[model samples]
Target: MHIGKPHEATTRICQASAETVEVRGRDLCRDLMGRLSFTEYFCLLLTGREPTDNQRCFLDLLLIAIAEHGMMPTVQAARMTLAADPDSLQGALAAGLLGCGPVLVGTSERCGKLLVEAQSRLAAGDDAKVVALQMLQDIRKTGGKLPGFGHPVHRPTDPRAERILELADARGVSGPHIAMARNFRAAAAEVWGKPLVMNVSMPIAAVLLDLDFPVATIKAVPLLARTGGLLAHLAEEQQNPIGFTMAAHAEAAVTYKNTDEGGG
Candidate 1:
């Protein structure tokens, strides 16, 4: 029968059989060469293909841009989950994703769409400045933060946006969309009397549009990249138990009421 033993890696089902198996030792560091940087590694894992150098750089910027933003909802969720009881990194991340539901950390795609719409308005014979200015005005009227314009944390210019724009310029990647983005930046400065340099989402949207990704997908890339940081934070929380406290922040905040309430 020649069935003395079976290899550890192989499994047998209720039968007397021996199987020969071959295994290769993995070199953690060696597997990283030419394997794309962390940014491209994300793409490879998600899209099942390696991104080109430009794509890699773009992906890297996107990942780093939103890697952490001072205990945002996603990070809070991850930490909170970890505090209950330490678990696998993936488990903690899952908790964070639960908190980042569509409304929380989902605006990149909308910003991308805004750029596409801005480009379309310009292409249809409208002045780029006019279109961008009108968009800014509309955002203000609606109490919506202009997605790719100014940043609350960064003044003068968002560092990530500046870097992406520099890379795009160095690569000689000028086009109508890029030109429109520049025009938009100029218009914002003219209206505000100060530079409202592009924010993180701006360059992200610009790069995706340049790469021909649908505007809607631009936001998705951030969500995807931010997961890496979310996972990292969750792992961190497991080591040091401090859950997210945003819910408490939300509950303890103040509220205001309209004074002209005679009609009511």
Candidate 2:
């Protein structure tokens, strides 16, 4: 039985033969192993080109900013997975990474898409504010939550979002996407009749887009960053071992009330 087209079996990402390993057209060991920072190598691998200084700096900053957030579900999942299978680091990492979804680390991609759409409208000669307002209205009408606009803990504003915008302004990378994000913030307030906190996801998306990073790969930023965080958690879990404690706490916190009082 044959699978995909014969051409589909190949990968453009990397190639390894006995004598050499090539990645994105560069000899990985000779050209990149010692010289490029992991962050730079990540950019090279994703983009098939080296990042500009600004891109490297912003990417590093965004990664650090989003990397750790104290006991998020992903971390908990990783820690618990490690506790259950102390021998498998890869399994623990996979357990955490698997949790990256629309409600978590994946929001960056959605927010990037949102900004990209808004930019398209602006390029088509739509007023920025009008586009933002219409977007909020359309989202609300469709009963969809506005991506990157609110957070459970950060009220009124998200400090991470503010800091990202500040750095982008200082570095001169605050381009149209960033401006549109701000416009959308104001428009969201007007449309909702209440201020919505622009979360880190929005700034992350805006900054990456401003840096010309592809929307399709925006989620990779958070995933990569959070992997670092998960590793950290796993390291601590190895030494301190809180995964079972967390599981026990969770079990204790939920009261399994029987809906059918006497039926059981």
| Each model's Cα RMSD | 10.7, 1.8
Whole-model lDDT per candidate:
0.68, 0.93
TM-score of 2: 0.95
TM-score of each prediction: 0.69, 0.95
Indicate which candidate wins on lDDT.
2
- lDDT tens digits by residue: candidate 2, 1-264: 777666645677899999999999999999999999999999999988899999999999999999999899999999999999999999999999999999997998999999999989988999999999999899988999899988999987899999999999998999999999999899889988999999999999999999999999799999999999999999999999999999999999998878788656
Off by over 4 Å in 2: 1-9, 262-264
* Number of backbone collisions per candidate: 2, 0
Compute the lDDT of residue 202 as modeled in candidate 1: 70
The 10 consecutive residues of candidate 2 with the worst lDDT sum are: 2-11
